[model samples]
Target: MAPNQDEETLESLLEASKTPEGRSRLAASGAVATTLRHLSASSPLTLPYLRLLRNLCAGEISSQDSFIDLSGPDTLASILLSSAASVEVLRAGIQVLGNVGLAGEVHRAAVWVRFFPDGFLRLARVREREVCDPLCMVIDTCCSGVGGRQRLEELCGTDSGLRILQEIIETALKAGYREEWLEWLLFKACVEEQRFLSLFLTLSSSEESSTNLDISLTSVFKPELLTTQHAFLLDILSKCLTERPKEVTVSGKFALEILEILKMIYNIVDFTTRVNAAIPTGSPAIDLFGCSLLILRDICAWEDARPTETDKDSLVNLLLDEGLLDFVLSRLEELEPPAIVRKSMVKEDNLFPVELEKRVCPYKGYRRDLISVIGNLLHRRKRVQDKVREKQAIPLLLQQCVVDEENPYLREWGLLAVRNLLEGNEDNQKEVAELELKEPITPPEISGLGLKVEVDEATKRAKLVNISG
Candidate 1:
């Protein structure tokens, strides 16, 4: 038989495999073994044979069995790893493997045993859409089960494997064409598979990360990817938290999943804060901290956004029960005064430097973020408001109502937090009313703006007024 005739035969078989009966017949006819044998016969016949194999195995368990039984995975992995193979051949081979992977756990394990940790990572570096898209499909399928997921963890345990994964994520984020499979692969590997800490460590491996806060995580991971995943999580939690109590109730399993996710976020925030005394001004850790707080704030707001008359396991209540409010308050107490306030209080004549706390929240808007979380927690929850008064947090919050250069919007967030703390709570309002009346400290920025803090003798309340008044 001529080579062209063989190509024509393979193409015919590929077309026939579109039907279920055709696929079953093709699998039963021992044609899979013949194609694997001929993959190395000539470069010209390889693509058509691979395409035929791919079509046969797609969504067909018997055909996939034929491919695996005939040692097709090993043969294809060899071709993909061969130096003589062209990009076109590699892409087609990968598509076949991806199809085989879609069958089930057994099929996926076969593919992972051959291509993973090196073959797949190498192909992933090719950077072409034709190859990367199918590669992503293969990895995503392989990560769908316990065995395959364990194999992925092993692959990522190596330094080279971790680097390759980072490159894949960074490239996918910056690629001209968007691929949903790549996103799914990342979510599977990082979120579902619990590989986020590993991937995060890989991204933070740069030495300058220790000294540079201005460097964005985009230097390693793309912002769009982070934003997309965060939004995805927020949307899911919103739906879960805001469901009407009468229609359907939030389940325990889902609540547990959400609690675990919240714990992870809190750990990231806690870990970053503890490791560094002064987080760099624009460091990735700072963004991570801010993002974590923002997620917590949004979750709290969504949990309280719709109040139910009946007692259910609410996320806000769960957060409070977990002492998230106390945690935030304790963190706030550890932070050094914002840069602007600290500068205003420094005495020019004194030679001694003020000793600062070792654990400092150095990021811009750190105060505002902490305050935002408190504000959301206080929303429609009288217990949180009363807790704030009991904790003596009201005075600390009032102190935030000054113009601080470092924490943008600190004043606004402070006002909002105070409002939420006192709303519908007479005890909190009375606590604020009984506080000693003292003049507010004027930062240089406020003084430059002709704004001065004044105490009204009649009302016995402090207010901002023009210097002329």
Candidate 2:
């Protein structure tokens, strides 16, 4: 047909793509195939046809279905990879790819695994802001897909794909566009895929154990490059620390696994400012540390009588080296009163505690969480128990158990921690036997003040008597 007829036909398709019913009718009449043919046959026709496909697939699954039914992506990918393809065609094609990938992971994986080998990744090299950002966004959304990390890593490992990806990440970060998603992708790729978490441990490992790490200067992954990525990671972490996480799971942990991984990246004890910022002033600090302690509790716990080191480097050891136990113990020491007061309402034991259990905890839930973390720490690792005993944790722990007998949760965890301390250790049992509990006696509450009868109508004078309860 003539150029005018081609223009008219492309215009009709573009108009049809704007509506669901129009797209369906175009699909039924094989108009999608006709458009794809025009896309490949006429270089002048590429942008209009690509625009049609992009609009068709934008929020409408049926339009994506119609495009997929015509094998539109392969045609687009082939055109994209061609050296003769114009910059405009490549730009339009990347947007269409993003739209298709957004349809779901299946379409995403197809586009990624096929074109990413050299097509789209190389397209990112284009310096045009319009093209560069859409390319990065396409990769970002694709990385979030089901098999994205694995496939992207495979491609990255083959040649300079990893470098190109890192470059893209750095560019996006410098431009300040969706840095968190970029950080997560980089983290998953490096930490999960490249096993860089071990490398990080080696880097942060204390000076004394430096000899045992066996890390070399000529390592597979360079430290300096990893440091650049880590700097961005730390930036993301600082933000999470300031605001209490809004999403939570049934077990009272952050809902996102990415945040969980970020948790493992660095211990909270070392970053006091960051950890303090993670919770509100009135909110208990226990929730922040409790989650980490719970994970450590699971790691160190044993089913049989024998405990095993689950990893080459124990997370518990990491916590220990970071002084996590000491931090919690010290914080508890700071928050604890000279005397824990239990009301004489229930005469359980002759501990001689104070009149009332003063409001020590900033929030209620923190009480149980703090003790539970400590209790779990004592359960498996004899090292932790030994440390606790050396730190004189028994007397303070016992006080918490008996001081507020009404706090069932605190009492339960405190009791369990005390039990774990004494279960297999005779020394701890003796220490507990020798422990002394004392509660300070406080003055009675002053009830009211009243005028006395000394003003017996003789002198209009008023006398006040103080009443006590």
- TM-score for all models, in order of appearance: 0.56, 0.45
Q: Which run of 10 residues does model 2 get worst, by summed lDDT?
A: 444-453
RMSD of each: 10.2, 14.2
Give per-residue CA lDDT, model 1, range 1-469, as digits (tens): 2344665566678888888888888778866776777777257777777777777787788878878888888899778888777778887888898888888888889998887677877886676777777788787778776677576776555565666666565545445235556656654555445555455556556423332323333344443223332333333234333442233333333333344444444434433343322222334434444555654665565444445533342756776787778878877766665555566555452422344543555455677778888888887688888888888877666666666666678888876776777667777765555553333344343444476544445554445568785
Error of 2 at 65 (Å): 6.1
Clashing pairs in 1: 213-282, 213-283, 214-282
Best by lDDT: 1
Candidate 2 on 1-469: residue-level lDDT in tens? Answer: 2334577877877887788788667656665556666677247777887887777677667657666767777788777777777768777888888888898877787777666656765675554555656676677677776777777666345334554554454455455553244444444444345533333334333323432224432341332223343344333333433232232111212212223432433332232222222222222223333343343344334333246665422544555665666755765664433222422223453443343433354333344545665776677567887888898776666545533422336656766776676666666655544431223211111011111112113323211223333
Evaluated at residue 167, the lDDT of candidate 2 is 49
Where does candidate 1 stray beyond 4 Å?
1-3, 6-12, 84-88, 156-161, 188-195, 206-290, 294-383, 387-469
